[model samples]
Target: MLSPNLLAWSVELFIKEPGSNKTVFWHQDITYWGMGETDDEVTAWIALSDVSVKAGCMRFIPGSHKGGIVDHEDTFSADNLLSRGQEIGGIDESQAVHSPLKPGEMSLHHGRCFHASGANRSDDRRIGLAIRYVTPEVCDQAPGRDWAMPLRGEAPAGGWSCIAGPRGLFHAADLALYDSIIEGQTATLAAGAEQDVSMYGGTKA
Candidate 1:
């Protein structure tokens, strides 16, 4: 449901180790993204392995995005997969819908959707690649600069700079760029967060 010529805000890999107790608490994608409330963003979650209920597949509340952004309490628990451990309270678990995906399958959700995943109890790992896409119209309202990789359209004029694609996997230059991105993005994501944000300081492998 996005427009043509989309740029990716970020592409992150979500990995839930087997028997891990880490959970993704219910929250919206746009809450801490530094982008103000808007429906101009979407995330494509592509499963790299089987994601079943036992493997902690994502569960979404039907039509919850219609209510727009809601308040989230950040628990900052070590067991939470989210950077802030954000959770929206008072959710009716009975209305939740589980999204199970097989290898190579995917699911797309709006930025404002209320979604979360439980702990993995399966024997195998659950992995998914999340691609956050944003329309050119969406701008970062928080502080500092933001980056985007041009995927399928004209380059944006401002608000986001184009990050270069990797020349080779694990290349030194590419790794340096990733470090710079995490350094800059940490400020935006950690803005207004009350607890220690050391989790955002790590460089991607």
Candidate 2:
């Protein structure tokens, strides 16, 4: 399991050009959270495969979290997450250390950490499981806007509410599914969880 106490988690695979996954961009995680400060979140990244710097591993900015969350940029590219911060003097990339791990290993990071991954220059896919954790204190931002919406099922004791604020990000294919859920075409999150009952990292665990 990734984090026994996951607030949100996903199982994802990264597949880029064959042996050309070396180029990478940088970005912060708080950009996905429509509400609350970056200082209010945390993440646990668990690798399901052997991850190396040369194989598109991730690195972290030294104490960048202390600077608080930077204002998010609208660009959709991930390659700029690293170079942009360095070019703008907001981060020192040279000081970062490439952190690698074996399968079943995990990296726990402060939500505000300045992090980036190398390109997936390898021939194989980069596989990992990630879990985003929160203290149940942060408000949801997926109510309105171009972000996620609410499913019109049974509401909580307080009535139907959002678990995240509107975030202008999506995986394209998943956006339509999300929108449908918002329009009462889906079930509640708790109900979905009960149906699948996945672990913190989207694995059976």
What lDDT tens digits, residue by residue, belong to model 2 across residues 98-176? 8787878988787667777776656665555665554333454443321222323332232123354335567665576
Pick by lDDT: which candidate is best?
A: 1
Top model number, TM-score: 1
- Assess candidate 1 and give its TM-score to the true structure: 0.92
User: What lDDT does candidate 2 reach at residue 36?
Assistant: 39
lDDT of each residue in 140-190, candidate 1, tens digit only: 874238888878778777788687688997999989888878777777788
Q: Which pairs, if any, clash in model 1? A: none
Candidate 1, run of 10 with poorest lDDT: 196-205
Error of model 1, residue 158, in angstroms? 1.0
Q: Ten-residue segment with the worst summed lDDT in candidate 2? A: 196-205
